[model samples]
Target: MHTPDPHRHTPVPPVRPTRRAAALALAAATAAVGLVVAAQGGAGAAVQGSLAADTQFYKDPTSQVVKWVAANPGDSRTQVISKRIASQPQGIWFSNYRPDSVTSDVRAVTSAAAQAGQVPVLVAYAIPNRDCGGASAGGAPDLPSYDAWVGKFAAGLGSSRTVVVLEPDSIALTTCLSAQQQNDRFASLARAVTTIHAANPNAKVYLDGGHSTWNSAAEQANRLRGAGVLNADGFFTNVSNFNTTANESSFARNVLNALGNPGNLHAVIDTSRNGNGPAGSAWCDPSGRRIGNYPTAATNDSAVDAFLWIKPPGEADGCAAAAGTFVPDIAYQLAQNAPDPSTPSQPPSSQPPTSQPPTSQPPTSQPPAGNAACSIAYRANSWAGGFTADVTVKNTGSAAISGWTLGWTFPGDQKVTSAWNARVTQSGAAVTATDLGYNGTLAAGASTAFGLQATYGSNNTTPTAFTLNGTACTTS
Candidate 1:
């Protein structure tokens, strides 16, 4: 028997940063964002609930909360949230570029998951101009550099089946870029899919589709298609936001339908920090949002692959704390306040509506447009990501117009995808939905109706102003 080395048995001093030893532990864990691969939610003292035999995953002990709970018993938040949310499956954000360790980390996580009969979920968010130079900026300097980084990132997946949530906001948030920049970004994303698949055939890659409250289904579908959805597994929604599962599921289905992918591409929704919905418009670590459903691949929906905790509940979303930093109290609140999925909600869309009448200084209600005075109404059945609208035009004037045309601009990149009951055409956000054969003419004091579908990027506000044949219509 060999004697112990002088350094092998050295005593280490503990660093107690206030009552929350969990905070200290959270500060030191690897894998950014919510790294996936595991059991239901957080596990307490003895790790309750039985594994789903062949349905569930995420057993490798790699969570920050796991370490915090084990290291800090005094911190009750560690046991509270960690038992249910943190100890479960989550996604890993390979945000930093440590090429040397990237391979090992990927192999370690995937290999462990595979050994335990689980599939690991990973996030590759190192695209150039990531987050549009916002709080989480500084991705690869350019496309070539990003490609090289993708190579290293994909190199980590070692044959075992893995689910990869690729590039959050890369597609849904492309309004920041110009036409040429968009082409380049899409090319880079396409390159990422090819690269990941070439490296690991077992890897299922998915591009990001903002959220239900953000992009419209059709617009997001086109964006997803442009970014090469065919090459990858599918697209994901609500990566780090608080949109509800019902809204996300409906929005994602609409997206997949619009894309018309032959292979019925699937989708995944992040059920993290969406319990109590958003606290105001506070997306960055809002106060009251609670943890959502536990991670599960057995999502009954045919189009949905899994309901995952993509963004770990406790981690701050670049606002409340230091961006990705974790706060124990926040974690505890999320866990404690998590809404019971078993309990049916009063309303399906639990989150507060973010849409408002977003328009330019147009005519108010019942404003006069031309000699044929007109009043237009803009109403869209909107969810987080997309919406369909019905516009009713009434000729307040006594003249009966032979034909009519309506024009409007979306507050954001809200583009019309399809139109019916009118001849609709959209260039950028400017829409021109001219009347069809029967509804073209408006008799004196007569009103006609036309409906259209459009998709938006972020803000799904109802168009504030409406123009009838070039004159602004009044809201009143």
Candidate 2:
């Protein structure tokens, strides 16, 4: 008789982390709005309020952001970053082809989630020619090695529910491969899916279906079919891409329809950084983007399986830093720029408001006596004709500032289109940003942040001069 696996039957203790009660309330409030999902195992519902406090998806304690937070306790951005970006559940990427360690590595994460009675999102990215020789390259040397590696990967599921995002860009970006090579790749993907399902029937494996803006739905469906999508649970879209959730949802539904809407097939979308939508077709670390909806299985759409953060926010897309490396500044910017969760719901606007110069002038407050009153830190990410900037206003004075207005003049022809955390208005190259009541007060040595999205014609230079309440401020 075969001995049963020892790791399979570990008893899961009751999960009652302190944040669970509060998360339940937030989840209930947003359930009607399609922001929260029911918890796995039917124990209770979960929301994305605190670090996997109430979500079915497990929050990996060893995630890059978590390590960053622990390493930099005194960083000014730590509090917000900890509460927002670091607290969320993100995909744990298994990108290497280390067959010897792959099973144990996978088991560690899955077993942790199992003990917590939560599901884990895992990305299988070790396919040959990964990323089409782009920034994220390297994988198993050949198809046979990859096939064996995938079998070991599947063996680590350990009798619990899990979500696996298999080989992003595999089906969608196979243009460079020859006819026979493409056929071989598809065969490998199909075999991997079979192995995963056979290993753990509780595992839901999703194949790659590129974003809405990439291939047409019919074309993607055909490719997914060729890669054995019918045998898989469904396909996933927008992995690591910045496409809006609404657009992705529609695109996924269209793809399902094209795939004959098999009852067993569905779609999951990567809503990691599509809150502000795409910056045209520019995919590599574009600016002005925000974190989208928190990961949830209750998308309220029958055709869609779940909305996932397949790409962890703040990890560079090979531009800002090496690909997959987490940058703290980007993480802070994304969390700070996210929409206010407590704001009342409003009708979705189809178009951005027309850009026009400010009609009213900034408040005329007398200048403070010295340059020590305030200082500013400005950082920006630019691509082609557009960019986004994050500005931090530090109170370098001894007294509290009850209200504040920040003014600056662009050295170039940059035009502000929209803003967040403050009210921004532009006239010619001059811009004024006033506190929006909530963030006006800054105690001695305290700081606050705001951001803006803008466009430029030929140049995009940082503004050197700034003023807070009409007092000149130093720049960094």
Candidate 3:
């Protein structure tokens, strides 16, 4: 997730944390002009190598995945991003940021990502009055023209790889605009989603959800509803910003709960650079933030949809370089040496870090004795192109898990290339598993994790079901 420091610019006071108005205008223009807009949708090459490497580890065929891989090579965390994208069958992204005069060329970009076996991560920001000249600046001029531009923008979608992140900061940062302006922005966004879906139904669209520190669940839900969250596939949170996965997940769940209809809504998180979490709510180019859990598809709760890299990390947010400019040197340094927040500290903690989402809170009233029920969520942290699985297991159950086992079946006939964090051995149709030094002897209502690094020939399937001590988890 990417955001500029509000305090840095005096003109743009940090008023209630709002969306970049330019995104709204961009949607309007795209609607009118059609997707033949311009070529301003792609990212600069600041952190292209690492970002690309992260996406290629899974050996996905998505154009964006391939773009990232083709851009970067010989790095260590390459496999991590690759595995994350490969875990899921599909995803949606925005196009690179280009001007409105040239062709939208959505098909060309989508084809590239599709060929890579992944989806393009598109960012729709060519709106008017974008960013209000704040941290995330630059956008189309006004609403009337924006509508025309969006029309061109929509026309660019190809049949292959594509996942559209429609106008990030468009909703969460609406506080800067008046009610009429807000309404206009929502109407424009609704139009963008409609146009894109109409252009290509396969193209998944996710609206931006403000970071964890920004909005309360109810506030964001109302904002989302006003912005037509129901009309879109799902909403996105933590784009080009900083927040831990655990914190973002919990926050998203809370927002979904406020919405009251999990069936109609899904949420995605930007896990690009949140490994070490945020630094005291600062949004500027702050030091010490490491990459968070790479983008993955493991769903701890049923409501949240997928984790994505909407905000390509290392792409300077105007501070490091031009906003949205992808600087490879800065990106490489970030990937290679981001600050680790979890490391044993020699000083006091600045921000309050929450433990993994509470596994299982004791029931106010116990269920029937024979039906003592508890749920556990498993997050597969490591999985890359070749083959590997290093999963962290959280025993969100009530009873102490004396002995535990985690297992999954691949999509094709893929086999584990290697194993780590736990003991893993494959049988005929099943793979037996055990905890590792890092994840074992999970106390009642505690959490632990383990994984295996494996290699795949040409046929490796995503694990269908995972069992903890023979108990199958609810994976939808």
Question: Against the true structure, whose TM-score is highest?
Answer: 2
Give candidate 2's error at residue 210 in angstroms: 0.5
Which TM-score value belongs to model 3?
0.54
Ranking by TM-score: 2, 1, 3
Write the residue-wise lDDT of candidate 2 on 1-476 in tens digits: 00000011111222111110000000111111112122222222422221222346777666667779999999999987786667666666777567997787788778888887778777777789866776666789999999999999898888888888888888888877998999899999999999999999889898989866566678889989999999998988877776556657777888999999888888877766666555534567766566666666655566666667767777667667666667788877766755443333222232221111123443434434444499999988676666778799999999988778899999999998656557789999999997655466788999877776677899898899998888899888
- Candidate 1 has a TM-score of 0.63
Q: Output the TM-score of candidate 2.
A: 0.64
Q: After superposition, how far is residue 346 of candidate 1 from its true place, in Å?
A: 14
- Candidate 2: what lDDT? 0.68
**Could you tell me which residue pairs clash in candidate 2?**
46-54
Per-residue lDDT tens digits for candidate 1, residues 76-181, read 5666676655566556566655556566656666666677676767766667777777666656788888888888878878887777878777898776799999
Q: Compare candidates 2 and 3 on lDDT and give the better one.
A: 2
| Model 2 lDDT at residue 307 | 66
At residue 136, candidate 1 shows an lDDT of 63
| CA displacement after TM-score superposition, residue 379 of candidate 2 (Å) | 29
